[model samples]
Target: MNAVWFVRSRQINRSISWWLAITGYKTSDRSFSNRIYFVYLVIFFAIWGLTVLALVTSTVAEGLQAFDPARPVWLAAQITVVVFLAWWLWSLFEASRRSPIKFTEEDAALICATPAPRPAVAFAWLVSAWFTTGLLFWALAITLGFARAEIAVGGNPTWADAPFYLSAAGQLLLPVILLHLGMLAVVWAFGCLRLNGYHSQGSLNRYPLALGFIFTAGLVFGGFEGIFFQSMAWPASAPVLSGSGLANYLPGNLAGLAWAGLGMGALYLASRRLNLSRAAQETSLSGRLQAASILGDQKLAASIHLKQRLKSGSRPFPLPGRPGALALSWKQILQSVRAFGAGALYNWSIVFALSLAVLLAPNWGVRGVAALFWIAQLHARLTQSLRLDLDQWPLFQALPIRSSYKLLAEIAPPGVLAVLVGWAGIAIASLLAPGINLWGAALLLPLVIFDLACGAAWDVFRQARAELLLAGMAPSPSFLSLVLSGLILILFLLPFIFFNAGLEAVLVALLWGGGACYLLFSLASRSMRKLGK
Candidate 1:
């Protein structure tokens, strides 16, 4: 008993240590510690608070004395809980099977040399697995059971009530069961493939089998439950069927649940068997590899060869230019812009998705949706530009061209892409909402161009600030700088958005902003030239 206690304590300590490591906690005396702790605490509290709020909202909705049958919030909550349970179960099973036992050479040596029992260590690991994985869900189920009981006693049922409740529960449980079956099949197939030595060879013969199992399981169980409930073959007069009329189909639901459980059990057993086989295979391979290395085998040596590659891949075709200062500056700007575009795909995809949705959606929805997409695109462009300015200052200095030109070049591609994409989105909106004049196109095109120019100038100023910070010449931008910049951009774009109000106002604003930006950029270019030298 004492030995068991020690093992349990050790396992608990190890679990805590592992969690800390994964979460990036380290013992350090840094000023940033407070900031890190504050962020962590905020996130933790926010998650817990949200979860509690959801639970309360769900409970209140369920406990209402007079309920609207059409309102589906309670049903949604029940479905959500069941889905959560299914996901929880799937994650737990996956974690338990995949978490490798940390058996070291030292451990093996100790096992051979010491009188200490290995069973204690094994027992502790088994217990840790339970707590780390499924135990949380088990506790959640208990809490949910209590919540359900309270709601059951608190509410008086209408004819639709019992059927609705049962349907809600069934809807939730069916998805969970189906999800579990699908995940179980996937894990089972992967285990089988690993056991069969197909994984190492990269063969995908088992993929179809795995996918088939998943689809078949999910569809069959989900479909059966849907049909059974729809048919309403069960007696409505039955006591269990009194409220929701769902208890009539309880037997079929149970059968489906049982089948899902059986699938999960089969997956678990398959996984265990496969895991044992893999351990044996790995042990055998380790022995063979050790033997080969000891024997000074040429093939083993060849297999272990390492090579160093240059950090940068082959360069693109160069323009016909002297290796002078201007040429070098152009190269740096090009490189930075190229890098920016590489990471812009995700943002661009979002823009495209929103634009397409707006085009396909109703005319009434088009304006609001297009505006949101426009805002999103603008944010992405600005953020990308800002990040580039922050990172590439040294490269900018090393370039042969003037710093201002380099900054302009960096902003040009995205600015152009943004305008084009924005126009395309507007065109889409126009198609959906007939009688909307495309005259805004002329105003918007120039506005986007002017905005881009202004944004580039602002980014250059921010970069200049960053450069100063690096050289200890100036302080970094305060929180106020960020707020002011955001406000300025919004203020600048406000007139452009309201171009339909008056073209003269739009044109005046564009000219004022654009002229100011160009002038600043020209001055910045001269400053950059001097700094670069």
Candidate 2:
């Protein structure tokens, strides 16, 4: 075998062994346990996959039968395209920040110092990263194909038709794989150029921004909207909307060809210009990030991510010179600015978009689910400021301010931001969805603040317990914490269910929200005092 394949195989084996060892399946003495564990995981995923497939087929059938202007298949196609484009741009943005392909310090010492071919080594790294990171996309492609196959067969078939299903999955998998491969290659090519000093990080970063701008402009003004949207939808919808033929399939076929051609071009560029020495220097960060993920150290992972963003191009936000409780709030703002800079705007934009979705949903049931999803996402963002404080517990405990003030200060900034962003979304939704009760929408602004306060309080309390036991490292939130938090938030929203849209509902919601916030705040403050001790 060539040296490239040999190195790649060894790397894969080492990763699997590391994971197995961490899970207490030591190669020296636990061979049987390892095999048993592997079999258990396989069986679990197989059963889970079958259940998901059954749900998908049934749900798609129901959605198709529904009398709605936005057909389920078309909506799915739109969402799939949007997700793919977002991921593609994100990959490029990340590549600009750090090398897409990474080599460990050992690889630097051995491979970089040796006469191993640079192109071959780059290809191996690309393949390894793609296989490991692209598993989700592969599953999504298969699921999409399965959905399409059900549509093609005109009914959901029994298990006896497994061969037909497999053939359909195979048919769609090739194009999706090719399209994914092209995206990866393009990102890898950019990383190679950046490592070779052929492109400045700042300039490379602008590539995605520029492409996004051009794409947006085209949609608004360039009159290619229908054609662009039709690319993913045409093949899926044509059978139902326009009758199936070779013409219906032409767009998808052309797209596959284009992606394949693009992959070849990008690979050629990377092969000709990749620099091994610079790649070796840059890859250590990737190794650190990967290790943190494998060990499930979220704080370490966040720190590494912050460090990478700082390196990419961070703008300095002015810090307050005052020292005390106020300093904590300033530090939160500073950390957010330094970590995300202008990119934070997109986060708020998502809040507004999700709000619009929740308000526009057809029924209270759909609206409730969307609102819950929105709250879950908001809770994650709300905890960022609290985490900043928790990460520096030693210094935080040293502050002269009382524990209650410190806790309140930590949660205040993000809670305020959430209120403002969510209120903006509500205002827009009121304008767009005329049926929305303006009074109810306005009442949500305060509820948003209290909701964040309560959620942040719980997060602080849970994190304090974790930090106390784990020493300095704050582990990711446990499943129990998430479940409890969701339940608490649901209770806070329960007033909307008990009282219809009016002053009574608004008053009850305010009382419930305030009561929950106060209770959680008291608990969290008590926990913070323990940390101080």
Candidate 3:
């Protein structure tokens, strides 16, 4: 096969693998035939059930709602939904085409050497496109039909009475869909062009820096324009072509259609012009300097190397100081707090501040509380990996350390940070909000602390199931963790939600209840020592 044919085949094969894996039909020697068939049956039922559910829910929800002729929000919402649907369809098609498949260098060479018929390859590509595009169109038609039926039934009117509403909805959705498709085409063109440029380079060193600059500039420009745009009102003079029979709307509609056609053409031309064979050449001067510097200052080079190792989460050379085991645990806690990225100690501080904001924000208290809960959950999961550094653990074990000491070490950084930040937030809010007493602020600290402690404990519990928890690091699977965290959050918020009964009474109840639960769990831990290990 030619290069294009080979690439398409590899893409299909990879998609098949992903489909099988998702349906639990492992394509491995250990997979049983019965398990494969069972998985297929389950997937078949799942897809059927989801389709049925969507159809039923959409029908019911639509039937109860009347189409308001005067409300622009409804039209805006419909356009937004249609645009999202189009983007979702495009993303699914692209994801299927880029699935990973392992291949050797020799296999690649052999495939490149083959000379397949271009017409046949093009025919195959067309067939794949037809199926994917057809599915999207079918879905769109079903959705539109369901929406129209719902509006007609709910408003107790015939199609003839409100043909204008249907026309208006269609007019709104068409432009949105076209805009989405145009954006996708632009992105596709950019990716193709970037890949071609990278292939021309023999080395990738400068590419990273170049890409970073491009990303930073894009963010700055995009954010600036977004804020600027949102502040301005839509131009009143812009022609609003609606409800004028489909034929009357056709002129403006055709203009939009023409723009979309131009965008698609540009994308196709960009793809064809992609320079796939170009290779980057390396700079020789930088290579020579690095060799001389290493020889001339061996000591400095070693120190620099040690710093790099530490940055990569490796232990420092010559070992850590001979602190007591508890002291060593404190050091580890401090390290986790100072560490950057997702699990950094600084993020937990933010979470603490947000929690206080939630408690104090007048109208926005509920939303702030929900956001705080999410941030705390995220911090816990992000920091859970710190325990995986076995080298750091040995230093603790070598000294006189108990499991409780280890657990305390794990919990201290997040707990203390959460408390301090939470207190500051409450103090700031109390200063601004009148009628808020000292007792209420004092009560808020314990509640926040308890919630944070529980979150930390759950994270540790998840680490005990390392394999499952690690697998769940991906955002999709992490939903289960989110759900569990949400439950704990509800428990944390219940006392505050009913604080009108008296702050002292609520605090006493929470402290007693939390203390009892903690003692019970601690006692239970003695029996479940294997998990702690």
**TM-score, candidate number 3:** 0.45
lDDT by residue for model 1 over 1-533, one digit each (tens)? 65545645664676565555555654342569755875796699666853564355356546532353543333333333344434534543443343222333433443324444433443344444444443343333323333343355444444555454434444434433443343334444343334432334234434444534553465357632355422332221121122122344455345445545554555444444343334343334343444456566534432322111123365764655445545643554565444444335777767756755644555745745564554545544544543344445565455565555565665566667766776776677677777756554545554544454444444445445545535433222234334444444455557756664477656666666666566645754564455422
Give the better candidate number (1 or 2) by TM-score.
2
| Candidate 2 runs further than 4 Å off | 1-7, 14-101, 113-275, 286-302, 312-320, 341-343, 357-361, 463-472, 475-505, 508-512
What does the lDDT come to for candidate 2?
0.66
In order, the Cα lDDT scores of the candidates are: 0.46, 0.66, 0.45
lDDT score of residue 325 within candidate 3: 44
User: Compared with the true structure, what per-residue lDDT tens digits does model 2 show for residues 1-533?
Assistant: 87776977888888877866765655556577778877776687777985686567556645654633344455444545555666887888888877777877777787767767767777777777777767776666556556656666667578877777666556656556666676788788877777764545557889887876765665565332367545533433332221112234556656655765776587667656566767777787778887888788766876887787767664555564468777776777666656775546776777677877876888978877777667666766776666666666666666799888887787777778887877787788778877767666566566656655555556556556544634655434444545656676566557777876667877887777777677777877877677532
lDDT of 3 at 35: 73
Go through the candidates in order and give the C-alpha RMSD of each one to the true structure: 12.8, 8.8, 12.9
lDDT top scorer:
2
- Give the alpha carbon lDDT tens digit for every residue of 33-84 in model 3: 7577867778888678545644553554444253445432334333433344
User: By lDDT, is 2 or 3 better?
Assistant: 2
Error of 2 at 513 (Å): 4.0
Would you list the clashing residue pairs of candidate 1? 162-243, 162-244, 163-243, 163-244, 163-245, 325-400, 328-400, 329-400
